[model samples]
Target: MNNRLLTAVFIAAALYLSGGFTHIAGAEDGVTFIPKESEIVSAATGKSISVKSTCPSGKRLIGGGGECTGYLNTLGSAALTINAPRPDEGAWLVECTNLNRNPGEIRAMAWAVCADAGVLEKNR
Candidate 1:
């Protein structure tokens, strides 16, 4: 059935897309991508992404990514800063807090979209 085929295709795409956490979403920065800001939240989470931000503040952007479990990503490499005077090849600044909690080797994947200026600019 067409519906079944579409479902299969979707699943395949998801697996292929999420296969690697490294290449997903723009740099770990906390900035938003000029073109695909929404991508940050699209397919960017998994059952393993137990850790997440609280009351996030930033521009209206989107991203896609996910987690595998046992991996803890830091903010300096996770948040995206979109307020830079000029953007790079879409590499936003990703500042994060360890929370001192990790899934333990399994590693979880995740992404964010926002205009974190202070943190990102200071570090960048």
Candidate 2:
């Protein structure tokens, strides 16, 4: 699979394991998958940019991912250097570098999946 697909699968698995799944009917499991997004940031050619998404009050981050856009080819694509939960467990951080030779701009953003901490305990 491609890097994007693999990353998505990994995030899904992490969310599932962390009790971030919501019910089909949206019933109260106290579990909520809150997707927090970072503002789009530009990375210059050969330069790296980092973005972060933080959970709201009373929510804890379970998993997260990121996207890099505006690239020429596989070799010139923006490569993600870091895509993981923050040490505080309340945010998600993502960093990517622009590999294009030209001084073009690339966009990168982070996504955070959050859930109620108490809900996680109840679900377990």
Candidate 3:
């Protein structure tokens, strides 16, 4: 009986050391996030202008945001707007407007994170 128990222990140790039946799980479809660079936005008459960044093929936008940069955002009346990425889409939209009723150009950047649909589903 002692010999049989020792043999069982040795077998279990070997299996563990050999990585048998481990079956480690990971992301489903290789989902990844990416950040987009800044883009240019020009608006007149306090009207809002939109800029967008799209992900590559076979990838979808997970989240995104934007901010307005320039003298107008600080000195002049300027505003920035960010919208969430739609389902299964790689489009991130941002709108910037000059709130001072003056014609000016402001620099804005839109950023987004993308991932594969299958991977996203696995996460959920």
Off by over 4 Å in 3: 1-42, 86-89, 122-124
What C-alpha lDDT do the candidate models reach, one value each?
A: 0.31, 0.63, 0.57
lDDT of 1 by residue, 2-88 (tens): 225634653454334334434332334444433211212212322122323222444432332323222333222222211222122
What stretches of model 1 exceed 4 Å from their correct place?
1-49, 53-56, 69-105, 115-124
Candidate topping TM-score:
2
Question: What's the TM-score of every candidate structure?
Answer: 0.23, 0.70, 0.59
RMSD of 3: 18.1
> Model 3 — TM-score against the truth?
0.59
Candidate 3 displacement at residue 19 in angstroms: 26
Instruction: State the lDDT of candidate 3 residue by residue for 1-124, as single tens digits.
Output: 1225634754564334334655322233354444454445556766776667777788766555566666567664667754446554567776667786667667766665556655445533
